[model samples]
Target: AILNSCEYGEGWATDTYEKALKDDAEYLTTEQQAMIKAQHALLKADHDKVKSMHDTLAEIA
Candidate 1:
């Protein structure tokens, strides 16, 4: 962004003057998103299992 500033103008990095025209967006690629989706289910299930165990212990106490 700094390198392109001269051609684009200063504050260009922060400029939302024309929001739809502003093109600097960042995100995971399709392949990265797919991998995360597969792993996320396992992670969420593990978290839910631990949470359930914690709740059971809390109830017993």
Candidate 2:
């Protein structure tokens, strides 16, 4: 069977760059840092909208 050929017998292997380095450090790499920055920006914008909505609802209540 295919599982017989695998070293881990069908289990996952850490042959990929990301998987190999994932545990080396929690620190983000350059590309990951950029993506994180973009995510932060979007979250900040969403948070501002939520705050505005709450304020408006409070005023109406």
What is the Å distance of residue 34 in model 2 from its true position?
A: 0.5
What overall lDDT goes with each candidate model? 0.46, 0.48
**Model 2 whole-model lDDT (C-alpha atoms):** 0.48
Q: Give residue 31's lDDT in candidate 2 (0 to 100).
A: 80
The lDDT, on a scale of 0 to 1, for candidate 1 is 0.46
RMSD of each: 17.6, 17.0
List model 1 lDDT by residue over 1-61, tens digit each: 3323332442342243223223422355667556555555555555556556656766897
Over 1-61, each residue of candidate 2 has an lDDT whose tens digit, in order, gives: 2223342321232233334345543676778756655655565555556556656766897
Q: Following a full C-alpha superposition, what root-mean-square deviation does model 2 have from the true structure?
A: 17.0
Model 1 sits at a Cα RMSD from the real structure of: 17.6
On the 0 to 100 scale, the lDDT of residue 30 in model 2 is 76
